[model samples]
Target: MRKFVLAAASSALLLSVSTQPVKADDDLLRLAISLCDFAKTDDRSSMRRKLKAAGMRLRAIYPAIKCGADGSLLRVATVNNAFEAAKFLASKAGDEAINAPEEDGKTLIQWTEGLVAAGDASKQQFVELYKSKM
Candidate 1:
């Protein structure tokens, strides 16, 4: 009975440890997506700190992840005008991702343009950044 209990406890510990990384990755992704909304309420310094931390975690998980059709984190950041977060993501994503198209075939440049049309003059920096990469 003692050996059985010990074996079961060991199995449970191993299972918990194995599952921890997946949960942490999911949390990082959630935090990355929420960064856009967080930027709205937080000061730039606070936002930058959060963005940097999230970026570090995401980089560890996905060292080569780019702004592909599925990288909704970049899309959300750009759409919400989370410039600092977007920039941090861009740094990790590389130059090719700067113009990568979404599922609808729209690039980050197009998204920034939409913001510009809506009177968001601040997005010009993003536009220029995308263009420079292209």
Candidate 2:
């Protein structure tokens, strides 16, 4: 009977721990998405606030914002371009991508190819920035 009670108590503790929501990271992900938008719209103030809220230090949103204003894939791509995408990735996985590709199998540089092709200077700048960082 004592063993049964101990087992139940242990199971309850494990369940509580497992059920805890990862709220902070979730906020970071949401902020990443918002930052991508601000990058396109050149809303530097809003971007700063969002990054601050998410506890992420601003890294590369400037170039991405430039690209956004210059009409890059920021306006077209469902996901943010390579720059913003890479920024989010770096935030979640540390700053060393080391040639890591996105889930869609494209390197960050390759992912921004479309933006470059469209003559979006911001996207180009982002690609250059990513090259330097990588």
TM-score of each: 0.50, 0.41
Q: Which ten residues in a row have the lowest lDDT in candidate 2?
A: 1-10
Extract clashing residue pairs from model 1: none
Q: What ranges in model 2 sit over 4 Å off?
A: 1-33, 56-94, 114-122
Highest-scoring model, lDDT:
1
Name the top TM-score candidate: 1
Error of 1 at 68 (Å): 15
* Candidate 1 structure quality by residue, lDDT tens digits, 1-134: 10101124323433475668556545444544444344333334554576577444433332233233334455556656767766665665665555667556777688778888899888788787667655
Q: Global CA lDDT of candidate 2, please? A: 0.45
Worst 10 residues of 1 by lDDT: 1-10
> Model 1's lDDT to the true fold?
0.54
List model 2 lDDT by residue over 1-134, tens digit each: 00101123323433455544455334433554565556545555676577677554554332222222223223322234434544443443333342545445666567666668877666776666556655
How displaced is residue 40 in candidate 2, in Å? Answer: 2.4
